[model samples]
Target: MSSLTLGFIPLTDCAALVAAEAKGFFAGEGLDVTLSREASWATIRDKVTVGALDAAHMLAPMALAATAGAGGPVAPMIAPLALAVNGAGVTLSNRLSQALPAGAESLQEIAAGLAAFIGQRRAAGEPPLTFAVVFTYSMHNYALRYWLAEAGVDLDRDVRLVVTPPPRMVEQLRTGQVDGVCVGAPWNTVATRGGLGRVALRTSQFWPGGPDKVLGARAEFADDDRLAPLLRALVRAQAWCDVADNRDELAVLLAQPEYVGAAAEAIRPALGEELIFHREGACVPRLEHAQWFLTQMRRWKQVDGDLDAQALIASVYRPALALEALGTTGLGAPVLGNPAPLFDGTTFDAG
Candidate 1:
């Protein structure tokens, strides 16, 4: 088998990659894979761009941002498949957490209380509260921005959003480095349970089924012969992950010292449903999903150049590759579009 290297962070969404290796799906596809565990999102991006690793479990928006010449030097990248969606939550400091009433239900109510907190902090001449996300061009950042923006919490003047690694989120919150965070599990669950912070809202409350991690590769590798075999292997791995019976084993696989490296019980809190590895028709990459990231970039001015989103989607998101790979196998019929509707009833025009 030919060997390839891949990069990933220790998060719940890296399951497909973990499954592919542990389940021998990659070997079945005639490939030998090495999964390098990196510490930060910047490490993933830099390694993938320079070909230090062949591919990575990457943030969808960061790939597009790289193409738009915003964060890094523009690199040709493509995401052949989405790994998972709705895998993150917002954690607030103990002080802020206490402001909300118990059993406070909806996102709207939470946002309203947050707005009041912001108003109070401003009135008292306190420094704007700071929050952290995984990366500058990440769904975590965008989701946090959208949730805050909906409540009239200005990203620029009212509060600051910084980047922090997943493992470090709880310490940052406890030390007052950041008052809140929007990070993927089981970090959020870990933070809340450890009493460092409280999970105020989940990314699902902002946009359910939103695209999360993806199989990101330099377009050179993804657009060539290697892409098909790779996608096929991952598709099979996703199927293995989606089986209800395999859920416990999946958690155990992800918790091994080589992968996510968290406790199995801690890992189980966000597995199965919270970090969805597969569904009836959700494996393929969607153009509208990319468009949502582009729209947020434009809305937040994260891009340096005027990006034609449709063209970017055409270039990077290859749903056809996922479809082609699925066809060759008995992996049921495919249905892989994410409509990505928001909870606030605000529709996204993915143009």
Candidate 2:
């Protein structure tokens, strides 16, 4: 038997990793897995790069950026499996939320209201409003920027973007450290429940079926014999998490102090229709997702302009590994075709 140590952040989407260890899915595959809860995405990246962690629950963009040496150290990584998708939401502090036009319920309306608010702040010569994201390379950052830009807000000129750990998002809001935050579940729900902030919009509203977190491992470990068994265990755990009947138990399990540590009530909402654990080949690390992330990195000037996009995507996203682990006989089709369109009726042009 081979032993591995995996890491995760305290977010609802970390369910599969928590379930794999709690439900003995890892042990069933003859692997002893330890799930370490890390404080930030940077820590997850650094630890995984140094081999302190064998694998981790990582942001889709962070995996690509790490391999390309965009953010921190250049440690090549691969995402053989995706953990979950579309669980992120934008939350504005109650002070900010109330300043918006009343009864503006729809996402576009809320975004427009925010744009108007930013304009008014600018006219009054107020300081540029600040929005926090879990990480610069995270979907939260990209999605938040896309939403604001769609509403005619200049990301670079009209707002200040900052980074905060997922678990600390609510605290930052409560202390008035930030005006808003784009982060994954449990934190958004926790903030709303605490009455410190209001959820302005879910990422799924604009970018349905968007990529979020993945099962990330160092590139050097790809050839290890234990890789197949680990993938099998994670796939099984993801399937287990997708079942509706298991959500209550899964929520309670994740509510433990060692895991997400949020109340089960706050965590349960994310497990609902908004958060997808495994369905529609969700576990497969689709190439289009990587392409979209690369596009965003280049759009924001985070990646080298001369880098080979196709080569980097192919090297970092390995769906063949997932197919190899699950075998061909019963493995369903991969998510090769384009996903559902965004709220504005546009899809990512990964071509």
Candidate 3:
């Protein structure tokens, strides 16, 4: 059996990887896999880049960023499979949420209320509100920025953006260290239930079916002979995780201290409703998805210098490898639904 070490952060979206290891899917593929729980996305990125981890549950954009050297040193990486999607949310402290007008439920209402509130704070000469995200390359960061930008709030000026690991989000909010956060569940669920914050927006509300996390592997390992088995094992694990009957059990498994480490009740909702692991060919790494991340990276000026977008996306997002892995399982890639409209009614043209 081939021995491999994989890393994952404690988030509900890390389910597929946790399931693959707990359910013996990796062993079934004649592979010995050890799952390492890391503290932050940067650790996952650097470890995977330096070969400390054979693969990892990684932010989709982080994989692309690592390859393009956007936010850190360039170490080419590839996402052979997406682990889950639609599992992130933007949450605000109770102080902030309560400041909004009563019954301001929609994103428009929330953003309008927030903009007015920020203006009032500016007049009062109060410090800017601080919002936390898991990492610079994460969709959490991009999604939060996208929503705020549409509201005419300048992330760089009107607010302060900081990096906080998923597990620390709730505590930071509780202690008033940060006013809000954009992070994956069940941290959002944790905050809301603990009465620390209110979930203002689900990522799905804006980018329904958007890419989230993926099975990120270094370039050399992706080309190795073991890549096929690794992908197949993950595909099986993802399919198993998608079954409704398996959710409760999966939640319990994820709630262990070594995994997501939240209560099963907190983890269950995300597994059952908030996250998509394998439905609609969710595991396939779509080029458009990668292109969209690149578009955001450029929109935010994260990617530097002139580079070939198409070629970079082609090299990083490998749906063909997913296809090859699925072939053996007698499964066909399902057609994905049409892209969902953004909150502002804007359509994304990844040109």
Candidate 4:
């Protein structure tokens, strides 16, 4: 049995992969897996492309971007399983949030005000407002772009997009190097708790049930014999993490210095903390949150050219494997195409 090398970035959502290995899920399947933490998404994609990694904990859109050959090193990546979802938010520096009209009453209102604020800053001769995202192909980047464009602001013109790792987002905002950021959990919680930033909007608000992260591998790897058991192990891990009680233990495991490399205290809050949009209050995590991400991918043209959107999503998500591993045929449903009409008045079909 060849050892499987997996790559991941150090973010809270990488918990499932870390816990699966730590809790013996992978070993149980007679596989030796090495989890390597990469510095950036580009490195992760490159390593996977060249076969340096057997699989990876990848951003949903990053995986799509690789398959689509958009703005990154070309690679044939496929996501046959989802690792986690709905763990991201948009964080604005306290100074910026405070300046918004009505002090963050509603996302649409704040977005409008943010556009106006950027205009005022430009008129005053200040540098264009800069926002940081973990990666260009990440859902965070697309979500930020979506919200800004909705407010009539142009991302390329109204602001500069900078790539900042999740762990550094809080400190970067606190020190005034950037105006705001869109990143995954623990970072968002850390920013708010430290009084440096506030949640302007969660990914959920932008599109409920958006896809966040997925277990990705080279397309050739998915066709290999090793894929089934590997995906089965991941399915079991996902089920274990979904249980409310198991989340705390999973959080502790993810917080280990060898895993996320963050203090346990920092990582724990992000796992169970209800969705808290500093101004909108808290709510439970929902599966619908993952769907929104897929919608954004379509909106951003991340899903390769002229491919059937439904087939593209179905090709990547293996609900059958997830169900088989969990021993529940109906436990999960495949999010291949738009199931129902969207609030934004967009319809996706299997063209």
Q: Which candidate is the best by TM-score?
A: 3
Per-residue lDDT over 1-351 for candidate 4, one digit per residue giving the tens place of the 0 to 100 score: 548999998888787678668888788878888999888888888888899999998887777667766776557677766676567888889888888987556777888899999989878988888899999778788778877887889666779999988888888998999989999877887788888888888866665545567777888886677777776676666656666787778767877767776666767766655322111111111223334445566666665546554554555555555545444423344334432332244433221
Candidate 1 per-residue lDDT, tens place, 1-351, comes to 778998999998888899999899999989899999999999998998899999999998878877666876888888888888788999999988888767667888888788888888999998998999999989898888888888888779889888899889888987889989999988888887788877888877677777788889898886566677888899899888888898889888888888888877778877766777768566777788788888888888776346677888788888887778888877765665447578787658332
| Candidate 1 global CA lDDT score | 0.83
lDDT of each model, Cα atoms only? 0.83, 0.88, 0.88, 0.71
What is the descending TM-score order? 3, 2, 1, 4
TM-score, candidate 3, is 0.97
The per-residue C-alpha lDDT of model 1 at residue 60 equals 89
Candidate 2, poorest ten consecutive residues by summed lDDT: 328-337
State which candidate, 1 or 2, has the greater lDDT. Answer: 2
Candidate 1 clash figure, as a count: 2
Ten-residue stretch with the least lDDT total in model 1 = 332-341
Model 4 spans > 4 angstroms off: 272-351
Candidate 1, residue 201: the lDDT equals: 82
- Compute the lDDT of residue 154 as modeled in candidate 1: 77
